[model samples]
Target chain A: MHLLAAELNPLGHVMDRNIIGGPDALLMGDPHGTPIVTMHMLTLLLATGLLLWIMNLAAKAITTGPSSEGNDRYLTRGRMAQLIEVITLYLRDTVVKPVLGEKTNKYLPYLLTLFFFVLMNNLLGLVPLLDLQHIVGAFLGDSHFAVIGGTATGNLAVTGGLALIAFLVIQVHGLRELGLAGWAHHLLGGAPWYLAPIMVPVELLGMFIKPAALAIRLFANMMAGHTLMATLALFGLMALSGMESWIAGLGISVIAGAFAVAITFLELFVAFLQAFIFMFLTAVFIGQLSPHDHEHEHAAETAHA
Target chain B: MHILAAEGNPVAVQLLPLVTTVVVFGIAFFILSKNVWPRITKGLDDRDNKIRDEIKAAEESREQARAAQAEYESSLKEARQEAAEMISKAKNDAKAAADDLRQRNEQELADLKQRAQRDIQTAKQQAVTELHSEATALAASIAGKILQREISVQDQQRLVEESLRELQPLK
Candidate 1:
């Protein structure tokens, strides 16, 4: 009876498709624990591969020739290579280098990976890959491989996993850059020693808060956008087909359609923006972990005195 | 449709997904950091450094060119000043030479004029003395011719007076 009802009510079907499935939809059934493959894992793996392939290609294309050769404004050969070079250089020079001044080089690779991975996942979400999977499954007699769709970053676990990684890198840097005594001083928040108890927890909480912001911010942005898009499309679909006459439905659907298009465009912008924010914020956090500048501390001391 | 769709450990993270994600991302990061990143960023850095070196070299060359131009301009100015000095000295020397030549020519011309004037004066004096003697002889001869015989002192005086009267017209 439930199955028949599910089939009859298209709205229920769409609502279920759009919002009802929770984290469970993010996973794919892998019965055996041996092969730990799921939809998010598949997308993650794909993103990693795509990044590797493109980066290698870009590496191969960049030139280090003498001045006697061709134009030298940019480093790479092709358009795609130019795009990659610009992104990498902009992020390194403008974003990463400014914040993490001394150790920009040391942690650049991970940062680059993070930015590209998030960006790729976000862009991939924009494509109707899930629809393609369904079409492909309908053509094939089964839908097992339809797992290759949806926002990989929309999964809390995936974003959480990335945050956890960022968490590790930030802490590790704090330890390395600040050292034992300096790190202890860092915990004191530059107040008198009596304030250690109050300040320590805030500093520690700050450590998690930064990465948590990264994870939640990414997950919410991606998921909310997709949800809104689905809801808008549902509106258009309902408007176009649910009224007394086809013309009436069509007239109303146009408004919904326009709104949907606008939001979709907005969603596209947000995808890139959120990914950039995640990267930019990570760099800022890592930069904060460096040892407090002595001159700055001295000036503060003088001012206080 | 999406809600009914269930796979793996539904809603909960299973062992395999976590492991796969870690493994895949790990491998990707490792491969990238080790193999790709070093070469790529090195290429980028190499290109960056190379371009910077080239720019520095260009700036250095520009500086050298500017210095050389300044030196050349200064030398040119010096040469012009030297040429002006030489030309002015030559002009001054030429003017002095011309003035000296003019002064010498004027002195020689004045000396010639004086000598010529003195020669004319002496010639005129000699002519005057000779004329005086010639007149006296002429007067005696005239007296001799007119008296026809020996004459007395009064006749001689009368003849001399007549001769003086005739010479007056000649003077």
Candidate 2:
């Protein structure tokens, strides 16, 4: 079974050196050194930019007025109203308040933007015209390469960059809340001076652990979903290659297509959920540094104790 | 010669994944601190203000509703009390008026009865006086006829005895 698996699929090693190869765009001398402007990055950016433009237009159309039906501006159109209501409620209940608490009000706007931007980018990765490809003259067409870019967050470089930003924000807020002396004291687990040697390294490690985990979580979810779909697609291609029975090939192809579609829907939900989770976790981490968070620190204290 | 130099070589050389990680994380940190974080925070403040305003407005509306309800109840209670007072006042006025009428009528009836009784008593005395005067005049005329002139004491005594016998028969 292992030999058959290897023979049936040559690209079994999913995490290849392709990641370290910088982006193909850079390789082709596109001169756009935007860190990871690879195929996935390009598609992700385009999708996100397009989604943002659409959201902007929707936002502009929202004027304060009474409609012909005597309904308020917020309820003027069913679809637009429904979309706005869902986003607003999700941000307020799920993202902002849970992390920021009463001061959630203070951070709501930033978190909402973060949620939308990440969500839009993740969702765009799941699109089709955004991703179909063709072959041309002994080589896969350049257009095909352009279309084949998959999930953005699936790339370690991208998710790591985002996590790094969150890390900076958490530290900045922590220092701001504690000032220099208090911030130093907090690092020592808010413990006695004698325990400083042990707690300092632990706190330093704790700092990196949070952001590292964030990067991994986002990267893993996006990468795993895309890889599963691609593998299923390869199964159908393999059947076609091995057999003269067109019916069997067609049946495998249909099954592969169905699997891709089901996975795409799941990926879409994960895209939104992960973005929300990242933003929410960022808020929660920052909120820990707030003046009112002594109780949470107390738990950390007991653990250290 | 320069084209030949570029020939037979891959166009792109790959950077180490570690180097890529550093470069990406560095750029993201710079951009976030300088541009993204500020814009996001501004948007956040706006959203915060909006939520707070909504919450405050809701609380104020709820308080106003409570106050209005209290006022309405008080006014309703006052109106009911006023109605009860008015009814009681109406009853009292009616009773007072009835008592005044009854007392006036009773006083008038008593005065009328006294006047009527006095008139009846005076009328009876006047009738008795008139009967007495008439009877006296008749008796005097009869006595003058019975007693003829130029008679002595014996004749007067005989006449008095005759008068007595006639009076007895009449009684």
Using TM-score as the measure, the top candidate is 1
TM-score of each: 0.69, 0.62
Native contact share for candidate 1: 0.37
Predicted structure with the largest lDDT when compared to the true one:
1
| Candidate 1, B79-154: lDDT as tens digits | 9999999999999999999999999999999999998999988787677556755776676777578767666778
Question: What is the overall TM-score of model 2 with all chains considered together?
Answer: 0.62
Per-model lDDT: 0.71, 0.61
DockQ of every candidate: 0.20, 0.06
lDDT of 1 by residue, A1-305 (tens): 45433323322211212111234242442333233345566677777778788877876676454567556533567988778778888898998987778789998988887887788888877787766775787678644236666777776667777787888888888889889888777877676889889988987776678688788889878877876776666665676656778887887678767887898899889987988888877787777677756456434433422
lDDT of 2 by residue, A1-305 (tens): 44344334422212222221333332444323333434544544565556555554444333333346343433324475347545756677776676567877656555555566567657766664323442331165342233334565666666676777778878988898789887787777666889989989998887888788787888788778766776777778777877799899889988988997898788888998898778777777777677665767557434432
- In candidate 2 the C-alpha lDDT for residue A220 amounts to 80
Query: Which 10-residue window in model 2 chain A sums to the lowest lDDT?
Result: A11-20
> Which regions of candidate 2 deviate over 4 angstroms?
A1-41, A57-77, A80-84, A133-149, A190-202, A290-305, B1-171
